[model samples]
Target chain A: GGIITQTPKFLIGQEGQKLTLKCQQNFNHDTMYWYRQDSGKGLRLIYYSITENDLQKGDLSEGYDASREKKSSFSLTVTSAQKNEMAVFLCASSIRLGGHAETLYFGSGTRLTVL
Target chain B: GDSVTQKEGLVTLTEGLPVMLNCTYQTIYSNAFLFWYVHYLNESPRLLLKSSTDNKRTEHQGFHATLHKSSSSFHLQKSSAQLSDSALYYCALSHTGYQNFYFGKGTSLTVIP
Candidate 1:
């Protein structure tokens, strides 16, 4: 079984400061995604990468940037942290089989606290 | 565009009772796939069940869900609720030939002993 690892499980940043979160997956999946989880709200896609150099924006892509530097690693950056931006960020990876959507494997998530 | 809605934000039940979580969705694609994911405390969210065929029931780990295209709903159900079943449940949707997936707000279930 493969695992997705997220670094710095907890993060504390000052308002207007820039923060970055990193993710790595050993599943060798072709697709990687970044999602934001808020209290009382489900996970919302921030960005996804279909391949090592490909990037796609989701509905909540604003104020965030993502990069897939390698097939196993994906990184997300918060341009400017806000007070209300305190939430957990999750990373996931999936493998498409026969051109069909497959199940997603997610990391434990990084909890961000902006003060 | 596709979106999922989970009506109940929190569900409290006693152990050994029945469990039911409502999930509805709206999408323009005909070949839409519905999914149920579970998130345990301090654990990463994972797929619990999924179905693409309409009217066909799907089950996993004592949980079941059937996609009803006519009603645009895929509600998760379990005959007996257990303390171990207490967790956050999320409903998701995705269409064939697309990589994007949409998720609902999620329902938090707490089964008291």
Candidate 2:
């Protein structure tokens, strides 16, 4: 079994500031994803990478850019933080696309607070 | 677009009692999948159950969920609720060819002693 690790569990930022969140998975899964969870709201997918250099956008991909620098690491950059934009960013990895091979495993979320 | 809805935002139950969390979904595609993910405080979200089989019961770790394709629902239930079962539960859905998954508003379940 492998684990997904996210850095800077807590983040504080100012309006218009650009911030980045990092995630690493030792599972060697081929797919990586970034999602944002707002209080009392369901998680929304921001971006996903099927392979090391592949990038795909989700419904909430705007204002965010993602890069899969390596097979184990995926990074998300908030182009500009908005005031009152407080939410938890979660990272997940999955083996493949649909069914038994398509289960996703999430990492401990990174809570971000913009002042 | 695929969407998920979990009606109750919070569910309070007594330990050793039965518990149920409702989950419903809508999708345009015929071949779709439903999933239940559990999130505990200070911990990451984990898969509790998943199923694509219509009208079939899927069980895991004492928790069970059945997909009712006719009803477009995949409600989760457990025979006995434990204090350790307190957590946030999310219902998710995805189409056969969709790259992104859609999740419902989370339901927070709290079990009291």
Candidate 3:
């Protein structure tokens, strides 16, 4: 059994400040993703990486940046934290299913509170 | 645009009652994939069920759902509700050959003991 760990379960950031969230997976999955969850809103994908050094933008990637520095880790950075922004950031990883598609295993999530 | 819709934002039911949460979707691709994810409070959402073939029932962990391509719906159902079954359920969709996922505004189920 493997686990997906996310750093800083609770984050309090200042407005306009840059915040970074980290995720590490022990499953050795090839695909990683970052998603945001706001109250009463569905999970929105911010970024997804198919392999190392590859990034795909999702609908909610405008104010975020992602990096896949290694196979076991993926990171998301909020370029400019917006005021009153409170959302849970989730990290997920999965094996590359290509045409078959695979299930995503998610981390516990990092809840962000921008003051 | 591709999207998923899960109505019934808050469903309150007594334990041991029949469970059903409505989920509908819209996509341009014919062969799209539909999925249900269960998220407990303050926890990451876990994939509960997934299916691509229409009219086929997919069951897992006492939960069952079927992807009806003709109706573009994948409604989640359970025979009996348990107090532990209370959680937020999300409906998601993806195209056949693409990896992008679009999720619906989740449904929260609260089973009272």
User: Best candidate per DockQ, number?
Assistant: 1
State the iRMSD of every prediction, in order shown. Answer: 1.1, 2.7, 1.9
Q: How many residue pairs clash in each candidate?
A: 0, 0, 0
Error of 3 at A68 (Å): 1.1
lDDT of model 3 at residue A71?
88
Please state every model's RMSD to the true fold in angstroms.
1.1, 1.7, 1.4
Which ranges of candidate 3 are over 4 A from the true structure? A98-100
- Whole-model lDDT per candidate: 0.93, 0.91, 0.90
Instruction: In candidate 2, list every pair of residues with a backbone clash.
Output: none
Which ten residues in a row are the worst by lDDT in model 1 chain B? Answer: B93-102
Model 3 C-alpha lDDT versus the unseen true structure: 0.90
The ten-residue window of minimal lDDT in model 2 chain B covers: B93-102
Best of the two (1, 2) by DockQ: 1
Chain A TM-score, cand. 2: 0.94
- Output the better candidate (1/2) by lDDT: 1
- Model 3 lDDT, residue B74, Cα: 95
Q: On a 0 to 1 DockQ scale, where is model 1?
A: 0.78
TM-scores, chain B, all models: 0.97, 0.97, 0.96
